[model samples]
Target: MGWRTVLVNTHSKLSYKNNHLVFQTGIQTEMIHLSEIDSIILETTNISITSMLIKRLVDEKINLVFCDDKALPLANLMPFYGRYNNSLELKKQIDWAQEKKEEVWLEVLRQKLINQSRLLFKREKDDQGKRIEEFSCQIERNDPTNREAHAARLYFNTLFGLSFSRQEETDINAGLNYGYSLLLSIFAREIVLNGCRTELGLMHHSQLNNFNLASDLMEPFRVLVDEIVLENQEEKFKQIKKAILALVQNTYPYKGHLNST
Candidate 1:
């Protein structure tokens, strides 16, 4: 239930002191306990951080996301051995059958499409929403029929406009990509924390992709980013980026109770 997300966007000297993150910029100084932090976003190029702080964040299993000059997340720091017996989890991950992976991926697709359908309904596109709902149920193992693509076409067109395409290099696309990258980094941290491999994936098997498993696990959560992009189409600001990153704090139904990512 750790909820604090620290953003270090300005030029500052950051280090670990007395189990607290000490930030000193000019004459102003701030201290935050490590236990209160869930994640840290390094969004500036001018900031300097000590190795001790990095090691502490890793040891504490706190997510550390580094952003590019554009203020978009580019990389993250994840532990190689998050569990006591990391080898055992690696064996379990490899032992997972293809059928089981497909089954899990199918459920993920269903939930993603269902969320897309709900968003469509909220936008007053009832027919498109129902079509997406039907496709959610019809999706087979690994989504062989590619209902997700069809649903995406309908969803984006209805949500934005007929002229809007996800491929387009626009503010909306940038925002979605940024938010999705943040979500991917969050899932990557969780996966590594559980001794899971981020390179292996159930459905997103890409040889060039290093975060395939995170991509698979983050599929359903992409809709949350899409919602943010749709709501802030006028402009893309740091506030919008922070809002998308805060999606991890929002509670969602899991098992029988609501949980935060």
Candidate 2:
């Protein structure tokens, strides 16, 4: 996997030449070797890209994300076949039993709640954090009792104030959404790279959603984005976005060892 997350915020023409991504804007020209890129975010609609570059990016399994007019992530390009044994992987995914799926989903939710509780504790909200941890312990097979929702309400209210709502049109909400979108893109890329279908999910099964599996897997990581957004609530959305994107370079604890995303 590559380490750099490239963002094209200005109007530029992108092309592929000699294993490098060439960027041209006015009289200035820049080139980056594709081998060094993990993902590229096209943050402006004014940018133009050639088909060759798109094909190269797909071939390299590089996540190419496009942003809307508001400069928020809207969609990303994913390869159709991500592994040499893709057929076998798809078969295995299809054969997953509902019981097993539920068990996996239970674990996912448990980890998410644990991470959320840890964040709350880090922020000095010990009482609310313990409550969230209690909710994590109470979750059962596929969260049939809806402890996740209950925990989320308490978590958000505790973190941001009682008056704050995720539905509200505020800069904080915007930052959170943007950060989540970035996480979704990263998760989707990894899922595809492992030769799995993003449309198939263990927990999230919305018929209209294309990244259901990614959504399911990204649950545990949402708290990371939430923490960044909370710490930078007073800053502009752009700065918060940069901080979230920088997470690609940060190392975190995983399986009793530190690993980079």
Candidate 3:
């Protein structure tokens, strides 16, 4: 069987039991097979971990990703499996996803813009204490057909503060976002060959798709490297190392369980 992630918080004990996963918030947890774990992310609120668990997780060739107080990944540990044919496929997947992905991203940005606009409007004008409804008509029924002009309008009217360039924010947003997509290509390829089905997106998935679910899961905090690297575009680095243990130590729980962005 392949590995799965085990995120620990709240001072727990963990181990393996014949390929079944087991861990506890208390002491002397049931045995857990190391082989069953694909990875482990240790995030503790008030618990000290045993060294044994760390040793086992490392020895089993399982990945380990770490997070911070914001539930964003601070670091990841992947066992070195030799480079395969995946890189070429990764480039192709990237090219395919770029066009459609941006169309989708722009739609997403538009929604965020509407929300932001409403927030600004509500604060500026008393547009609250009343039911606000959204309709398709809210989107331009006959939006600009002129690509540059349409894009410019969307930038100024829709997204003003997201990018520094006022004149080319739409394209700039597109460029930054498109760059992230290419970045995700690296993640998607790994998750796929790592025996993951990427299509089961955490937030946006229609049926009949097969990869990038891991990409979907990884999106919110994709900017970890971006903010560090001065935006997400940079010549590849050996690792975006953010050290998992100390980072995740500060995070709180999500709905009683610790999760990463």
* C-alpha lDDT score of every prediction, in listed order: 0.88, 0.92, 0.43
Sort by TM-score, best first: 2, 1, 3
lDDT of 3 by residue, 1-261 (tens): 233445665566554444445676545565456765555655443435555555555456555555455333344544333145656654554455545655554454344334433433443422321112132124331234333233333333332343455345343444344334433533654565654445644334667544346555444333332333232223222122222222222333556996432
Model 2: clashing residue pairs?
A: none
Expressed as tens digits, the lDDT of each residue in 121-214 for candidate 2 is 9988999999999999999996779999999999999988899899998888998999899889989999988889999999899999999999
Judged by whole-model lDDT over C-alpha atoms, candidate 3 comes out at 0.43
Using lDDT as the measure, name the better of candidate 2 and candidate 3: 2
Q: Estimate each model's TM-score.
A: 0.94, 0.97, 0.32
Ranking by lDDT: 2, 1, 3
Top candidate (lDDT): 2
| Candidate 1: RMSD to truth | 1.5
Against the hidden true structure, what lDDT does model 2 obtain?
0.92
Candidate 1, residues 1-261: lDDT per residue as tens digits?
A: 257888889989999999999999997999999999888889987889999999999999989899889888999999889899889999999899999999898999999999899988888889999999999989888667988899889898988899998888887888888889889999998888788899999988899999999999998878888888888887756556766766766777778998887
Q: Give per-candidate clash totals.
A: 0, 0, 14
Instruction: Name the Cα RMSD for model 2.
Output: 1.1
User: 1 or 3: which has the higher TM-score?
Assistant: 1
